[model samples]
Each structure stands twice: as C-alpha cells, then as structure tokens.
Target chain A: MILTVTLNAALDITYHVPRLQPHTTHRVGEVVERPGGKGLNVARVLAALGHDTVATGLVGGRTGEALRAHLAAAAPGVVDALVPVGGETRRTIAVVDGESGDATMFNEPGPTVSAQEWAHFQDAYRELLIDAHVVALCGSLPPGLPVGSYAELVRTARSAGVHVLLDTSGEPLRRGIAARPDVIKPNAEELARLTGLTEPLRAAHEARRRGAYAVVASNGPQGLLAVTDEGTWRAAPPARFEGNPTGAGDAAVAGLLSALVEGLPWPERLARAAALSAATVLAPAAGEFDGAAYERLLPQIDTLP
Target chain B: MILTVTLNAALDITYHVPRLQPHTTHRVGEVVERPGGKGLNVARVLAALGHDTVATGLVGGRTGEALRAHLAAAAPGVVDALVPVGGETRRTIAVVDGESGDATMFNEPGPTVSAQEWAHFQDAYRELLIDAHVVALCGSLPPGLPVGSYAELVRTARSAGVHVLLDTSGEPLRRGIAARPDVIKPNAEELARLTGLTEPLRAAHEARRRGAYAVVASNGPQGLLAVTDEGTWRAAPPARFEGNPTGAGDAAVAGLLSALVEGLPWPERLARAAALSAATVLAPAAGEFDGAAYERLLPQIDTLP
Candidate 1:
C-alpha cells in the first residue's frame, strides 16, 4: 500500500459567481466542496488510477468531519486513517468569477497542533509506514509544528524501509531533503529556492546531490525535468492546457509514485507523470485528471533523455 | 417569549485581513464565526437584552452542527428550537480588509429544502408560535421554496394569536404583506421596490394600505420612519454612525420586538429601535449592539411624532 500524508488537510470550497468586485456583495451561483491538500490531492489521483492508497493526516472539528465525508464519497478506494486533533481543520475558499474565469483564494490557517497531537501523529505514521512500500509526505506544516516536521517524517519512513518522497517548499522541503528521501519533487520556483539555480536541469542535479536519490522538478508549461543516478530526462505533453492548474503538481507526484511502485523505467515514468499532469489541467476539480485525457496524451508525450 | 425564524440561516465567518486584493491568496489574521441570518441576528440581540428569545429555522449536516455548537457556546440564553433538514447549512464570508476597513462579502446559497424538510420546519414553527408573544419571519427564502412561503408563515402565526413582524424583500415580502403581518420593515431600496414610490414616507403609507398593520422604513443614516395605526414617527440617533451596517436592520427588529413585548408606545419603540440600530454600527459583529454605545446614545435620541 502507498501511504500519503497531508499534515494540513483542508476543506476546499469553490464559489462560482458572475463577477468578483472587491469590498462588495457576491451572491454565489454555485458552491462546490471537496477534501484538499497536497498529499490528499496525490492520493486522490492514485486511487482514481487504481493504486492501493491510504490517506492519513490531522483532522478535527466539524470541518474535518465534512472533509472526511467528501473524501469517502469522492475517493472510495483511498482509506482514511486520519489522526484526530483538538483544533478545527482549515478551509480554503476559491471564488471563481465566471465572467473573468479567474479564482480569488482565501486560505484559513490550519488548526494549531498541540504537543500530544503531534506525538499521536508520529506513532500513527510509524504504524502506517510498516505496511507501506512507498510514502509521500506532502504540504505545509500546521502552526505549532516544528519546521523540521517533514524531515522527521522522512527519516522515520526511511528507517521503516518505506521509500519516502518529499514534496513541499521552504524549510520543510530543505530539511526533508537533508533526511535523504528517495524522491523529492519541486516545481520551478521551489527548485530555485532549494538550489539557487535558474536552470531546471542544473537545479535538479544540485537538489539530487543534497541527499535525495532522485530529484524531479516541474517547469510549468515546459513539463517535467529530472536528475537521477540512472540518467537525466525531460518530458513534455503534446499540447498546452489553459484551464485551472491548481492540482496538476500533485497529479504529477501521484504519477511518479505509481510508476515507481510499478518498477517502470525513468523515461516511461516521466511520460506518465507529464501526461497525467497535463490531463489534470483540463479537469474542473483541482488536482484531478480526466482518464480519457490522460490516455489520449500518454503516447503523444515527448520523452527525451 | 419572542420567536424569530430565519428561513435561510447561515454560518457567518468573519475574516480579518491586512488587505484584500482580487485574484490573490489572503492569509486571514483572525476568524470570528457565529450563527447568522436576519432572524438569528435579531434573536442574538434580544437574548443579550435579557429577552426570552427562541430561534427556529432549518439546519443540517456538519456545517449545521457547527452553527448549533457556536450558538450554544455564544448565545446560551437564546433557545435553539431550530428544525433539522437534509442539506447542510450555508455560510457567509465577510472579509474585512484592515487597510481600507471595508468588507467583501461572499454569500453561499443555502441548502435546497425538500418538501419533507419544509414540512418539518412548519411543524417546528407551529410548536414554537404557541408560546410566543411575538414572532419574526426574517431574511430570504432559500431555493426550492415557493415565493409565497413567508405569506403562509405570516398567516399561520396570525391565526395562532402571535403578532408577526416580517423583514424581507422582492416577491417574498410582497406576498408576505398580503397576509397582513403586524409589522414590515424595509430599507429605502426595498420600500421603493415595494410601493414603487421614491419617497420613504409615501411608500410607508402605501405599504400600510396594502394590508400591513404598520410600515417601518429605514432611510440609511437618517434613522427610521414609521407609518402605523397609532401614528407616524421619526426616530434618529444622536449622530451618524459610519461603520459596518450589515446587521443594523436586524438589531432594529430586536429593539422593536423587545419594546412591543413590554407594551411600550410607538414613540418609545421607535426610539429603542433607532438606538439599537445605531449601536449595532458601533459594535464589531454585525448584530451585536454595543451596550455602552446604546446607553450613551439613548438619552440623546430625537424621537418625534
């Protein structure tokens, strides 16, 4: 089973309105809600693609219950082993102005994790890691959690023989990479912050040398760039997608993790990851890919090494 | 006992932010949540002022649970006799940008009530009306509900010997007035829309002639105008209050209801309503009337007949 951890899971609400005028009233025409966070995003895709996935994270209060209910109904295959906490789960509102087709996001800070909650998460994670072939530690650390939280997760997963993948930014990513996760996936900006290099390939190489076995970096429309012991590769989709690109990154992580579990070659893995990500951009819900879109774009992907 | 019905109640979420910019993510500084809707807002103030207020309406799902929890914790004196439905309660977001001191509101459409749910609400409303001295039917009717829903509610309350006060707009208010609710409060725009008269006093008289026992019109900073069977009166606060006026109307309803139960004269009722409405503007939360501000402004109010 593949384990995905979202330390700061959210109840994502999308409000559709005709237009969004700042400091004015907007009567939303439609409201769509779902469970969200980087790890949950990845787990959702993996489950949709028929991967055996378990999603574990901190969840509390009524918002947490709503998130759990949504996840169950939306992604039935993904087992929820969430750790209970004291504080309420956070919510992210994306007000989509239908006229402009632009989204304005208001993010609520996730619940403060008490010391006891953190300890509970550690024990729960260790138990989950024992049955996992691969584990993906994803998203921001909630308040009251140390900056090295992901690093601790990575080290623990590795100690239990679970191949750990770290996908985050800032101190958590920096510290997690130092713990030598099997894989580290960063977008162009996050990669630059990690290695201080503007060029994707060069930055991925620097990132790999910093302790990760393989470094995969996303360059927006340019697609995936990777550096590993096996070889270096670049993968691009057939065409560009100009829709909501909110969860495309997480879809790429799911593709990479899924391919790794299946023992696919590096080039094939990149092609799959790139195709899934491009397909996700065409989907209405953030981080979800259309199956037909992915299948159609799979062979058309340009995989060069 | 004062019974207030919020047909379309909400979980009001207030987000305090440094600044509000379109199409950007805002990290909220603080979050204050309360159970809201016009009737709930009225019930809150009545309870604060030591009135035996019973609040009833439709609520369901996890969001509904959160609303109940908040109401229990914040307004313990206000009895929650709310009806349970199948759909989750809606939420309204008020983003207060600290820099400009302006609020941007995003109101979610409340749950769609099935016929069964509407019937349940009717049963609950009838039970509460039995012991009520006054009943307030407030706010808009949610979708899937007929436009004449409030008219039925008004007629039912009148038949039960409960004095009904209505505060709404558009087709709902127009139909509700035909049932002759004891009092109908409309702001300038609503009054104009109802009577098709640009003049407030003229429209108030026209509204009363159309079967309403009394017509109370709010003319923004000018305070309230009343045309009742007793007499016509104008009540103004000591001075203009330039602040959030989202729930000032609800506060006025609370004030009017409170004085009416005490058998106060029209002049005194109008004075209390105007003072409470003005004090609401000075308070942080929409419906909360500032005790100090209300006390300070009470003696200075200009009440004329």
Candidate 2:
C-alpha cells in the first residue's frame, strides 16, 4: 500500500467564461468541481494505475465533508481518507477562458489547524504507514502547523522502515530534506529555490548533496532529471505535445512511486515518470492522465546520462 | 410573515485580493461564503430587521447542502429552504479589491430544474405562503424553467391571498407583471428593458400602466422612483456613499417589503427603500445594511411629486 498526505486539501472549482474583465460581472458558461490538492491528485493517478493507495489529510467544515463524500462516490475502494474537525476545507477557483485557453486561479488560504488537529492527523498517518510500502508527504502546510511538519512525518515513516517521498516547496522542503527521505520531487523553480542554482543540472546535483537520497527535478515539457546514488540520468518525452500542463508533475510523482515500490531500476523509473507526465499533458482535464497515451509514450521515452 | 422565493439560489463566495490581473494566479487574502440569491439576500436583511421571514428555493447537490448548512448556522430559524433531488446549487464568485472598492463577479448558470424539481418547489412555496403577508419572487429563472415561471408563482400566491412582489427581468418580468403582482422592482437597466424608456419616470409609469399596482425603479446612487395607483413620487438619498454595492438592490427590496408589511403608505415605502439602499452602499459587506446609518438616513430621505 502507498500512502499520500495532503494537509491543506481544496475543493477545486473550474469556471469557463468567454473572457475575464476586471471589475465587471461575467456569466460563466460552465463549472466543474473536483477534490483537489497535490497529495490527492497523486493518489488519484496511482489508484487509476491500479495501485493500492490510502490518502490521509486534515479536512474540516462542510467543504471537507463534501470532498470526502465525493471521493467516496468517485474512487470508492481506492481512496481511503481521514478527515479532521475544525475549519472548513480550502477552495481553489480556476477561471478558464476556453476561447483563449488562459486560466486565472484564485486560491484560498485553508483553515488553520490547531495543535490537537495536528496530533490527530499524526496518529492517523502513523496508523496508515504501518501497512504502507511507500509514503509520500505532499502539498503545503496549513496555517498554525509547524514549518517542519513534513520533516516530522518523514522521520516517523523512516523509523517504521518505510520508504518516504517528500514533495513540497519553500520552507517545508528546506526543513524536510534534513530528515533524508528516500525521494524528493521538486520542479525546476522549486529546485532553484532550494539549491540557489539557476542551472537545472547543477541544481539537481546540489539538491541530492543536501540530504535527499535521490532528487527528481521536473522541468515542465522538457521532462525529468534524476540524481541518485547510482548515477545521474535525464529522461525526455519522445515528442513535444500541446495541451493542459497542470498536474503533470503530480502524475510523474505517481509514476515514479509506482515503479520504485515495485523495485524497478532508476532508469526505468525515470522513463515511466517522463511517459506518465507526457500523457498527463495530453489529457483534457487538469490532473487526469490518459492511460492509453501513457502506454504509447512509455516505449518512446528516452533516458540518457 | 414574509416569504421569499428564489428560483435560482447560489452559494456566494467572496475573495479578497489586492489586485486582479487577467490570466494570472492570485493568493486570496480573505474568503467569505454565504447563502445567497436575490430573495435570500432580501430575506436575510428582513430577518436582521426583526421580521419573521422564510426563504424557499430549489437547492441540490453538495453546494446546495453547503448553502443550507451555512444559513442554518448563521441565521437559524430565518430560512425554511427546500432541497431538490438533482443538480447542485450554483456559485457566484466575487473578487473584491479592497483598495479600489471594486469587485469582479463570475456568476454560474444555476442548475437546470427538472419538471419534478419545479413541482417540488411549487409545493414548498404554497406551504410557505400559508401565514405570509407578502411573497417575493426574486432573481432570474433557472434553465428548463419556462419564461412564465414567475407569473405562475405570482398567481399561486395571489390565490392564497398573499401579496406578491415580482423582481426579475426580460420575459419573466413581462409575464409576471401581466399576472398583476402587487409590486415590481426593477433597476434602471431592467426597467428600460421592460418599458423601452431610457427616462426613469417614463419607465416607472409604463410599468405601472402594464398591470403592476406599484412600480419601483432603482436608479443607483440617485435613489428610487415609484409610480403607484395613488400617486407618483421620487425618493433621493441625502448624499452619495462609497462601499460595496453588490446587494444594495436586494436591500432596497427588503426595505420596501418591510414597510409594506407594516402597512406604510406608498410614499413612505419608497422613502424607506431609498434609505435602506443608501445604507447598504455604506456597509462594508454585500447583503448587509448598517442599522445606525439606515436609521439616520430614514428621516433625511425626501420624496417629491
């Protein structure tokens, strides 16, 4: 079983408008709502790929209850989530202009979690990790949570003899790396922020040297770069494609975790990650990967040193 | 008892951002969610003004559930809403820039009410009008509802010996007025659309001539004009105020209904409406009126023949 954690989950709402004008009223043509957050997205893709996954997060209020109900109805047996009490779940509204393919996002700062909520989440995480083969701590920390919250979870998972993956940014990533998780996935900008290196290759190397066992740097359409103890490798898509780019990084993380849990070689894992990300971009909706596209792109992905 | 009917109810979401730029992501500084629709807004104000009001509407899905829960928590014993089986409630997002006092609104097309949903809502409306002194049919009709939806509701309320106030636009307003509603409130644009007269006095007269007992036309900061069988009067605020004006129109309707339920004369009702509207414009949040400001402005509002 693979475990994923999202401390600040959101109910993502996408609204399609002809155009967005500031200080004016717009009639939205369409609206789509879904359960969202980095960890939830990763866990969804993993479940779709036939992996056993349990998603644990701090959820609250009516929005949290709705999110849980939606996940239960949509994913059923695959998604197991633990909800906490208190502030309502956060929301992310994406105002998409379909004609222009431009999206404006409004993200809410989710509820503040109390110390008791953190302890409750920790207990649930420990219980989830007991039967987990690999654990991924993902997304931003909610307000009132300590900066090293992810680091504490990583240490707990490591002590339980489980491989841990840390995917976050800024201070959380900075503090979490000290716990030496087995894998850390950071995009190009986040990698630059962590290592203070503008160059991708140098940044990947720097990140690995800073206590991460293996550093995976996702460079958008360019593909994935992995710096592992075995060696460094770069994977690229066979071809460039045009489509929605949101959630491609999370798909790559899901692919990497799926292969790693199955004991695949590092090179194979990189190829799978690149292929999965390419497929995700090809999918019409955000955070959804086309399985057929993934299957076709897998053999075509090129891994090089 | 005052009964308010919302054909299209929405979960109103307000996000505070420093500035709004098209096609960019913004981290909202603050967020507020409330049960909203024109009738719901009127009902809330009436409840706050110490009136016994019930809000009936077509609510569904998780958003509908959230709307009901929010109303229950915020203003318990104020709303008696009916939940439909299909289609989630719509949402309206207002991006507010506090510095400029400007808001960009994105309104979703509410759920398509099936025939069954309409029937269910009509039954709920009949039950709510049992002890109601006035019934307000507010906002636009949802999809799949006929254009004469408001007219049917007005006729039903009249048959039950309840005075109906019709507040809407286009075909719904045209058809609703033909049923001889007690009152019709239209903004400058809607009045122009209904009467094809750019002049406010001419539009109000034309609306009153078209079977409505009283026609109230709200002309923004200039205040209100009313044409009734008794006489014609224009009510103006003492001064222009600056604030969020999203729900001022609804507040005006609330004041008009409140005055009418208390058996005030037509000129006094128009004065109260104008004063309440000005007070709403002075309030910081939408759908809220400053009680002190309203009281102070009440005596200052002047009506001229």
DockQ of each: 0.84, 0.85
Query: Can you write out model 1's per-residue Cα lDDT over B1-305, one digit (the tens) per residue?
Result: 99999988999999988888888888876788989889989998999999999999888778788898999998999999999888878999999899898899999899999988898889888988889999999998888899999999999999999999999999999999999999999998999999999999999999998989999899878999989998999999878888878789999999999999999999999999999999999997666789999988877889988
True contacts kept of 1: 0.85
Residue-level error in angstroms, candidate 2, position B236: 0.9
Is model 2 an incorrect, acceptable, medium or high docking prediction?
high
Candidate 1: residue B22 lDDT (0-100): 88
Best by TM-score: 1
Per-residue C-alpha lDDT of model 1 across residues A120-218, encoded as one tens digit per residue: 999999999888999999999888899999999989998899998899999899999999999999999999988899888888888888899999999
Question: Which residue window of length 10 is worst by lDDT in model 2 chain A?
Answer: A74-83
Which ten contiguous residues of candidate 1 chain B have the minimum total lDDT? B280-289
Give the root-mean-square deviation of each candidate in angstroms. 1.2, 1.6
